[model samples]
Target: MDSERDELLHTFVAEAHEILDEIERALLQLETGRDVYDVLQRVFRATHTLKGSAGSVGLGGLSDLGHAAEDVIEALCRGDLPLTTPVVSLLLETVDAARRLVAEVERGQVERSTSHQEVIARLQEARRGGPAEPQGAWATSARRATEDDAEGATSIKSIRVAVEKLDRMADLIGELTLGRNRIVRTLRAVRGEAGAALRDEMEEQDRLCRELEEAVRAARMVPVGPWFRHYERTVRDLAHAHGRLARLVVVHGDVEVDTAVVERFRDALTHLLRNAICHGIEAPEARRAAGKDPCGTITLHAAHERGGIALRISDDGAGMRRERIAARVRALGRHPAPDALPDHELFGLVFEPGFSTATESSHLAGRGMGMDVVRRRVESIQGTIRIESREGHGTSLLIQLPLTLATIEGLSVGIGDERYVIPLRAVLACCDLPRGSLAHGGAQGLMVRRGRALPCVRLRALFGLGGSPPPDERVVIVALDGFEAGLVVDSLDGEGRTVVKPLGQLFRRVPGISGSTILGDGSVAMILDVDALLGGVVRDAVPADALDERRSAPSAAGGSPG
Candidate 1:
């Protein structure tokens, strides 16, 4: 039927785009990287695969382009054409044409887009000058056919599922989790024999519920490798444009994160990489004078840490000048004494809006932008980013992100009568705030625990709630990166799996609060933005009327979160 054909066409287009991205990365690698023969063979087979699939789908234009590209690859493998800059550039342009053809197919025009004659003509012209194809040239290292096992059918390790379907599954599982929490809470009050029996069975049900929730979230997790690899061409092109040669090195890239994380952080990561290339890396002459490698290195590393994923993008470049950044902050009147601030806080100033240390703006960077967008994007994902730099050495921006935004291990704490959920991952320790132990530091206070001092922010005062500090005030130590801060609260209610629901546009810009969740007693609990709270972005005073929606416990918290 037409429906089946359309579906198959859609699948082919999706896969073809992925193939194009891989070809671009391999082509870039061919110029500067090792293993040229292997890379050439891979390119040859990918082109063949593209051609076969495009033909099967009735995409004659894409198939033709693929065939043309295959000829160029064959010439390379035959040693008839050299792998020079121009060759790589021409092949990359061919990829661009193929991508346009794929887009045309995606738009329901499979038979034609444009002729794609310009690039194809260039390809043929380049081939005319090469030596004639030698006899049996493919024998030395043959391009692979689509490999098959004992059976002719290829075994599929994965299948494409619609993201909408996965999202709905997550929504249903979240409700189940909330229902499980309600059951656990209701069972706690029962103490009689029959009640005890029911509670024992409920415990087993709870275990099953947890397993189901975890399974759904795990299904949403995707390996971070391809997502990072997508930016290789960006780095390569940017480095070449600025006359600063740089290479991206990926380490432990197989670490998996939720697909939602990649969706939200893609633009943020791109901006960060742009900043690294445009501002961080130095010209080859300057690098040689500094006794460093002529080609700068940008390293990307990902790993699971602090109950979440930590993505580090670092570069061996000119690095950040702390003194210059501090002087600029003071000159801008953002901080009067930037020198007294810690390195993390000082470095964080670069993310302030329109804050740039560069004297002039250019096409790529130094327009007093980007870093602020990085901060906002990271916060929007309920993640944190910090900078570490040594002058004349290098700079690294480390981002910490939750495994899944749907739910979290949350510790409930009371401020007045209102409850809040501090993501348990960000909560280091909870203790009573001993009387007079908080030393005053301007508007904020500092808590000294075990000889280590941490800045403190009281939720009561920050939220504009009218309340006096109780004799037994509590402090929750929440930290990101190497910086620590104490969140002053009233009481600890316990811990559990808290399902997150976004607060609509009304409170979207509210500092120190990420989202909301339902707690056991059928009360609304605001999820604390540990990143915001720890980073010292305290609100002067949130209006009392504006906070009634958050502070007042909703009469029906058991209802579905919208």
Candidate 2:
């Protein structure tokens, strides 16, 4: 009995935290120029549900806070209280206190503290200042709407699965995917020697295995909407605190991505938003002087790309100045003026540890820590980040992430005796590298395909494998972070679903290689990090005109990416 009760308490804690996040998001929406009455209903239901759940679990402090919040929301909906900034601020603070209470419960510290009482008092003060509650036809309809909202929330069905269990399932599926690849390779090798019926059966089994692997990955996919919504309160509170009037607009909220990616990106996104408020968006008076709207806009957009999702956070305010950033770069003892460097490399300076241009430190940005952490977390998931800025215009940050981390569609290529896998999303095209195309003493070469010049890299020399280019070497074009390069390889080994396995600490620092994977032939293949490889070896060698042509070209093979 004790065990069962403990399980219930754990479940309640998780659910309560989720409910609190929803409440905070809804409260933030109230500050937007939308129909405040409608948002009040959502806040009311969320608070009421939280109240009931807390009471059921014997969390008296949380229940009391929720009850007070619910009363304030009801008064606002009934027109007894005005939806002023202070009311919204008070309610938001209450949500934060509730979140802390939930965290304490998770930590096995359930007793309420002084903060809970403080929140309850504020809630009461907000409600007491309101006029007498209305009781007429309007009250009747409001009551009915509230009841319907409560019913809808209660009727929604959900089940909780521990995140650790999900991770384990993903790991198991990864191993199974690897096994499936091995079976497919074995069957292909024996296809000519085996009987017709036997080959047919084997083919069917291969198809089923592929389907199962996809199903497993699909099961772990989650919409990024809830995570985006949770940031609404953060943006609202931070903007007000910084005296920068800003609005957070989210688009394509229904776009789905790997749950792991969403979880990993939460803190990075928070830091980015905070940075935007602190350094990107200017004060209201400054904006008006600059002939811009007084209220700045920060928009987050998520959408499907070729083989992954692209999340863009753009702000319409004072953009980053290249010269100023260059000055900071010099302070850090780095060479090449910021204007001399490409936009990608220049903006990436913000992600350097201990890189900041702020004159003073504050609760938000400064101390030069956020962007570097963002970059680390992003790369940890095998994702890429890029920034775009125009002075006095705006700044946009784009993060491209794969669908899932467990398995990826990869193309295998051979160079001499070793094999390598390049993610299909990064592989643009395959073309022949004609003989005697050497330039710059073979350090870097340009491949002219169909009147378009593409900067190319020789893999053999890059890895120091001590082998000359073969007569029939093929160049595999890969596109990453708006740059395109042709990778010289011996031959193509076709495409396969490559299951990713993490490398040890020793290999983790190795550049150009992301992780290792087992091939169908039981051989180990290195997974190429196309972005890192291109960033390291080709970005500087590639001319600006060639890359401009690459971007102008329509096909991904030309390195033009959405």
Q: What local distance difference test score does each model get?
A: 0.75, 0.76
Q: Model 2 over residues 1-562: C-alpha lDDT tens digits?
A: 3787779988998788778767777877776659778878888998999999999988899899989988888989998888887777778778768877887877777864668887787688779994222224223322332223222222111214554565576566556656666666666656454655666876787677667767767767777776676566556657776777788889998898877677677668878888898889999999999999888889999999978899999999889999889899987877656678877789888889999999998655678988998888887777888899998998999998888777788999998899999898887678788676654226557777766667788787777776666678888888766666888887889888877877899998888899988777667899998878887766665567767766666653353211
Ten-residue stretch with the least lDDT total in model 1? 145-154
lDDT of 1 by residue, 221-265 (tens): 788776676566567666766677787888897898877777778
Best by lDDT: 2
Predicted structure 2, TM vs. truth: 0.79
Give residue 422's error in model 2 in angstroms.
1.4
lDDT of 1 at 49: 91
Residue range with the least summed lDDT across 10 consecutive positions in model 2: 150-159
